[model samples]
Target: MRVEDAPEAWEVVSSTERFKGRVFDVVTDGVRMPGDEVADRDYVRHVGAVAVVALDADDRVLMIRQYRHPVRRLLWELPAGLRDVEGEPLAETAARELAEEAGHRAATWHTLVDLLTSPGMTDERIRVFLARDLTPIPEEENGFVPRHEEIGMPVEWVPLPDAVEHALMGMIHNAPAVAGILAAYAASVEGFTGLRPADAPEA
Candidate 1:
């Protein structure tokens, strides 16, 4: 629970409006040292979020291509969202986001793991989930079908082989999405990794 000898060495600095009018705050804290000494430290205080790494019956990973305004780049990542309300449980957020963002429901859903997106100064954690037996129920106000170039958020079925390949090749390069993929792979060893395009024994 503690970090660098100071488990609770953080406090919210200033709350501000996040994207879509969401509110977030910056946290300032200190690192507790030996003999209970404290040194100043600060981080981006975030409520954290949940991300789902879903797989269809065909063993394909569901992904979304998003054009991040901040980074000014298009990224392929697992469906993810911020924790909306105070009493909102992570699973609830995950399920809701999976539908709203990815437009799908999982017949089988399980929490794979939790990842600290940035442990240096921020407590930004993202819960990684493994979702299976998915059914598409597209959400309104999502995808390129809605606003096209204005919002480059679209879902695509990315095969596992290409997923890893592109990742290794620096194609699908989003931190949370990459973490979700690795976590999913660690959870289901019997499920992914083994065959490659070059290993097909010639077409």
Candidate 2:
């Protein structure tokens, strides 16, 4: 059936916060199914996030290799961060993350894609921005010193096609990285006219 015509199969009867953390909140929902069955579901509520696919003069994409403890590996990923700051514009968040994680700034920005990181589990949305006209920020010139995940993150500029190959070969597992690289590659094939304005509403 088409989603627009699909019935509302599950109605939330009640919801309570099960846990609250700095990054996200877990809520337990008591839901009523269409067949009169009731069940409890737990999922995470998040503040959303942004990722940057910063393409440079020679057509290389800025990338970072960072240690993800849960995954127990240093995974290659696009510069990204949570939209934890209340009321921060999404474009600003993308720009901030690009500089913070990759130590670069972009003069041109476009909305590459909007992603739901894991739709079945969390309400985490990520806006992936295509950044161009790149300029580097010296370590001493950056506003905040890198820490935690950003500290010593391995930064690199990989050719855009190489990044897409890495993703297709299962060498790049980060969701945003895979999607951003592929999407950016596709945009290039289309002459980049498909990209939306950075401030445009999520599609």
Candidate 3:
């Protein structure tokens, strides 16, 4: 299942963590490359994450507006979360994030897209799921209090086509959100018969 364009081009000789953070770690790797070349590559090692492109029966996409301090902008994005829970399945991560962030659950789920957030900078992979047939869960029933950045986040339901237009028009800058909306729109154009299983292996 190797991608023809992504051949293994380097062999790692050693790896050392330069800095460890709550979310990710910076690592320096000594590698041997073709033509007897050796080099040190510094990059981020991430725990990965999942996002949900949740659509209701009316075909509106659920989105959240949250301020990203690093980027210094408020972004409208699909519900997403880090894969911090060890041994959690990817689909389960998506479902949990949907509930925790958007307070919704879906009866139908399918894998929409998998993305390597930044190939040269981080080994962070994200799985985006198409979630349909949604039911909202009240905060009293979920018993999960939104904190930190999640506090006071604004949630909205935008028409899917409008979302797709926003994503394509650069209004949605978050990588997973843009990709998820475009993927969902493309799937809809195909009558949604081409979506992969929720647990499909990453390509």
Residue 60 C-alpha lDDT in model 1: 83
lDDT of 2 by residue, 1-203 (tens): 55542224478999999899999999999999768898888889998899999999888999999999998999999999999889889999998888888888999999998888897789799999999999989988888777887788888989999999999999999998999999999999987898899999764
Measured by TM-score, the strongest candidate is 3
Report the backbone clash tally of model 2: 0
Tens digits of per-residue lDDT, candidate 1, 10-85, equal: 3433344333224446655555666666666556767788888898887789998888877899888888888876
Report the candidate with higher lDDT, 1 versus 3: 3
For all predicted structures, in order, the TM-scores are 0.74, 0.92, 0.94
Clashing pairs in 3: none
Instruction: Give the higher-TM-score candidate: 1 or 3.
Output: 3
Question: What is candidate 1's CA lDDT for residue 64?
Answer: 87
Number of clashing pairs per prediction, in order: 1, 0, 0
Better structure of 2 and 3 per lDDT: 3
lDDT of 3 by residue, 39-99 (tens): 8999999999999999998889999999999999999999999999998889999999999
Find the candidate with the highest lDDT and give its number.
3
